[model samples]
Target chain A: MTSLYWAVADGWTITRRDLTHWVRQPTPIILGLLFPIMLVLMFGFLFGGAIAVPGGGDYREFLLPGMFVMTVAFGVEGTMIAVTTDAARGVTDRFRSMPMAQSAVVVGRNGADMLDSVLVLAAMIGCGLAVGWRWHGGPGATLAAVGLLLLLRFALLWVGIYLGLVVGGPETVAAVQILVWPIGFLSNVFVAPETMPAWLGTVAAWNPLSATVSATRELFGNPGWGGQSWIAQHATVMAVLWPLAIIAVFFPLSVRAFRRMSR
Target chain B: MSVVAEGLHKCYRDKSALDGFDLTVAEGRVCGLLGPNGAGKTTAVRILATLLRPDGGRAEVAGFDVTRHPAEVRRRIGLVGQHAAVDEVLSGRQNLVMFGRLYHLSSARARARADELLTQFGLADTGDKAVKQYSGGMRRRLDLAASMILAPKVLFLDEPTTGLDPRARNEVWAATRALVADGTTVLLTTQYLDEADQLADDISVIDNGQVVGNGTPDQLKTKIGGDRIDLVLHDADDLAAAAATVSRVTGADTDIDRDDRRLSAPVRNRVAALVEASRALDDAGIAVEDIVLRRPTLDEVFLTLTSAGTGHGPRETGRE
Candidate 1:
């Protein structure tokens, strides 16, 4: 616990450093939100009303949940890429040489990525609001929606962190980016998972991304799977379980990879 | 003792980085680790610093086994790595304070330490400048200062001046001297032979993942003998003739540096080898362009000894 204390503190310091770099550079920060915003502009208007939402009337209403999922996807890969860059730049090697904490590297990276995810969520919510997509469930529902979104982001964060450790260098980080597109598209973000063909729908519904969005629609009293879905009734557990499953499986693996790399 | 390693064997997969490497550095002595590239000099330093674990054997720093009590080891050790650990985004002052905070020092103590280091390193005026704006010399000073933030008993410096300009290198040498004066022991690795000469109380030459030679600089130099006879000839043909003539007169080994037309060889005694090479060169019609005998350097000693053994002899040990 004491070791973790110094490590986490160090990690937070590194986060502040990373943030300062972003603040000074400003390019990546602008680029971070541009893709999501561009998607909001492109898809929100073009596909509005043409695609059916999971729980309700407006296609933009359905699109809001999808955008939230996209935000997590868009943000988490950046964490992985930044880690690979650190490895290539010898920053990671430099840290290892210091008397600083080892676990702090991962913990700090995850913590910083979480901060970015929050900013991404805010931008996404603002965009959704601008596009006439409303969160009718008010304050409690908004908090619940964000809670669900954070849970999913936490899960994806571990996966990205692990992938970052697994990938040897920066060049391979792009290959990891390919997985995000498929995972994001397959979820209930844009359309109801049940509405898809039998096999993909089953996968889409079971996927943690879809689980969060499905549970999110239930909180907002948004349309989801014709009111008969199993996910709607057990929404709270699914939301918590997804992050737990991700943390359990990937967290240790990432830690193990981190340990292996220290050699 | 501030640092001790006994039979540490570290292997990276199929490659061994440290094999039965051993050393003990007393408090307040600057121990220099000298070796060429690919030698395990950095590896030994890392293990002693508790940054790496050996597959076999043990190491202790400040009376704590590095593997078992890493936090304790960390508490008593400061490391200035070969590269600067300062975050480029942070200003010079911020970088020092960040390290201070990381060491769990109080705000006041951290600030005081930062100020002292800034004054000592000559970085006081540039405190507000982002590290990226500082010159190479400034960065090296800050790196040394950052390592001293907590004033640990032992400091590890891996190649403290590999790329620094001569003036900047001297600045670092002065900083290290100050640390050693204050009773801080240091373990340093360097490819520059002069660096070891300038700072080390004891020298260890690591080659091919093992300790080839370890002793005081004079002790290591003695392995190549006290003196060497250098004879430079005008023509390439004279080199071969001179070698045969000198080998007959004195039984010392001979080598002619191909590019420089410099013929160098071991001698039983400087005076004896000089007399012999001269008489032989004159007798064999070898025009000796220049001839001089002087004390061999650690560089010559390292080349002649350490014996990578292309079928030379058994591994010699203990300053022989």
Candidate 2:
């Protein structure tokens, strides 16, 4: 019990350290928050006219849920950049050398990034409201949707940590950032995958991001991709299962990568 | 001993970072691991600091086995790596306080410790400033201060002043000396031989991932040779004659510099060797332009000890 207490305390200290970074350099956080907002406005106004939702459903309602999922997915890059930068700077090594709990560093990183993800979700939701996006699902369903978004962000946290340790520097964060865009656009974030070629559409519909987007649209009582595919039919279950699967694979992988750094 | 390691080995692909490296550092004394690039100085320090596990052999630090009891070793030792590891976005005070907090100090105690270290390291004035604004020297000092948050029993500093100006180097040296004065055992690694001469109580000379030589700075200097008598003659024609005369007097092989019309030979007695060489060159009708006998610096010891013909590969002054 005492050991667990100290681990939490140590992890909280590192989280606070990251929080202080947010306070000290408000530019990056503000810019990061602005990025998704800019995307929402761009896709909603500039590109929304071109994107036709089937049955003439409201594009804003369909796009908002997908946008929330994209916002959460985009978090992977920031976490990767922060983690790799710290590793390159040797701060991670410094923490390893100290008498702190082994998991504290990663735990603290997840905590801080999750907090950032929450703020990001709040900002995107506010932007959605401004752009005439509304949810007809009651409060419980809305809460579940928010919960799913956070879970996806949490799972991506481990993926970012693992890749950050593997890459070992900030220079590669840009490469990872570039890869995130294709993943974002390939899913149901903008156009319904069904509009693509049948094979390509199947791949996109199976994408983990698609599951979260599809599930959240259902929870938000918004328009979703109308498909008879098993993945689309089981979107709600897949939403919870996909993040859990990601966490299971990458959590240990990330911890192992972190250990391998000193070796 | 605060630390001990034997036959520790680490291989990174084709390069052996630590090859049967051995070290022993007595309590409350600074032991400098002197070496050039790729000499395993950093590798050895990392292993001892509980950051890396050696591929072979055994090690103990601060009475805990590094591989088996890393947590305990970590508690007793502080490591300041080759780079300044403090958070760049955080203030100096915040960085130190964060480190203290990670060590499980209460909030108030952590704050107090941060202030104390800031004052001790002469960073009090700029403690509130973001670390990104700190000069390189200031960052290094803060890095050192952060490592000492718990007043660790053993401190591992890997090239603490590698890229600092002489003035900044002196500041770090002063701070290190103060730490030693408080009975903190230090293991400092450096390419600068003079840094070891200034700070290390005992010096370990590493080359090719092994301890080629180890002793007090003076003792290692003696291992290479005693004072050297350097003679610059007026004409290149007199070089051979001067070399023979100096060799005859010192009973050591003389190294010649044809461009400078110079020859130098190691000698046991400083003043007597200088006077004797001067008289011998004068008698041989060799017009001497300059002659001096000076004690061997650590630079010469490192050169002689790590030179290609002596032990390692072709001499490449790591500075270049």
Candidate 3:
């Protein structure tokens, strides 16, 4: 019982350290919040005019829900950058050498990043409301949609931590940043996958980001591709399952990586 | 012993970082692990600090086995790595408080300890300034403050003053001395022989991942040779004559440098040898320009021990 208490206390202490960074240096957090807003405007105004929804529905509504999920997906880069910076700077070794609970470093990082994701989601939601996007579903479904987005963010957090532990330094994080774009665009977040070639569209439909995007579109009562595929029909179940599966795989990998840091 | 390691071994892929490494540091004493780059100095420190586990052998820190009871070891030990490990974005005071809190101090106590350490390390004036704005010396002092929050029984410093200017290096050395005065057992790894000569109670010379020599500074200097007398002649042609005179007076072999018109040889009695060599050189009409008798320095001891059979041969000292 005493050990468990210290674990939580130590984790919160590390989380507070990151929170202090937000207060001391707000520019990075402000820029991270602003990037998704810029993407929302660029897509909703520039590409929304020429694009057509699968059936008859507004593209802004379709784009807004996808933008929320995309915002959550992009959080991996921030987590990776923070983790790799700590490792390179020797801060991680200091933590490891301390008497604090062993699991607190990664756990605290996840907690702080999840909080960042929530703030980003809240800002994107406000941006959506300003640009004339509404949820026809009641408050309960909207809350579930937000939960699904966060669930995806939580799973990706482990992946970021694992990669950060494995990667050599911050220079490699830039390559990971560039790779995020291709994976982000390959999903159905920007457009209906049906508009692409058949093989490409199928691949996009199977992307984990697409699962959250499709499920959240249904929850928000927004326009979607309205495809007849089995995966689309089961978007909500896949959304929940995909992130759980990711957590199952990457969480252990992350813990193992942290433990093997001595090697 | 506050820290002990027996035949510690670590390998990185095909390369061996530490092989058959052994060390023991007693309580309340500073032991300097002196070695050049890639001699496994940092590797041995890491293993004892519980940051890395050796693939073979056993180690203990503060009476706890490093691998089996790392938690216990960590609770009693502190580590200051090669880089300043404190947070750059945070102020010096904030970094200390955060580390204090992680050491499980209560909020009020953490703050009080932070203030105390800031004052102690000479960082009280800059305590509120962001560490990024502080000088390199200030950052290193802050790093020391962070590690000392718990008044750890044993502290590990890995190359604490590698890049600092002479003054900053002195500041760090003073801080380390203060810690030792408080009964903290310190294991410091350094490449600078002067640092070891100044701070270490006992110096261990590591070469090729093992200790080549271990003794006090004076003892190690004596192990290589006793006091030596050096003479610089007025003319290059006098080098041969001076060498013969000095060797005969000192009863030792003389090394002659024709380029510098210098000759040096070891002596059993420093003053007697100096007096006899001056008279002998004067009688031989060697025209000696300068002569002095001095103890062999730790640099000479280090080169003589580490440079054996490495093919580079022993280089000249006083180059730096």
Q: Which prediction has the highest TM-score against the true structure? A: 2
Worst 10 residues of 1 chain B by lDDT: B311-320
- Candidate 2 - CAPRI tier? high
**Every model's DockQ:** 0.40, 0.85, 0.82
lDDT of 3: 0.89
> Candidate 2 chain B: minimum summed lDDT over ten consecutive residues — where?
B311-320
Per residue, candidate 3 scores C-alpha lDDT tens digits across A1-263 of: 39889889989898888899999999999999899999989999998899888896899999998888878878998899888888888999999999999888987898899999998899999999999999989999999999999999999998899889888586788888888887888888888888899999899999999999999999999998888889888999999999999999999998888888898
lDDT of 2 by residue, B201-235 (tens): 99998999899988999887666666678888999
lDDT (tens digit, per residue) of candidate 1 on A1-263: 47767777888877876777777667887788888888887777886647765445777776777778778877667888877766654467656655677666777777788888888889888887888888778889879889888888888888888887787676676676777788877877777767789788777777777777777776766556653557545766887898899889998998888777647
- Local error of candidate 1 at residue A247 (angstroms): 0.9
Q: Which stretches of candidate 1 lie over 4 Å from their true place?
A: A1-25, A47-56, A82-107, A192-197, A223-236, A261-263, B162-171, B307-320
lDDT of 3 by residue, B12-83 (tens): 898898889888888998999999899999989988888898999899899999999999999999899999
Q: Residue-wise lDDT of candidate 2 within A1-263, one digit each (tens)?
A: 38899889888888888788888889988998898889888888889999998657888888999989888888999899888888888998999898898889988998899999988899889999999999889999999999999999999999999998898665688888888889988888899898999999988999999999999999999998778889989999999999999999999999789878777
Q: Report RMSD (Å) for each prediction in the order shown.
A: 3.5, 3.2, 3.0
- Candidate 2 colliding pairs: none
Clashing pairs in 3: none
Q: Name the runs in model 2 displaced over 4 angstroms.
A: B269-272, B307-320
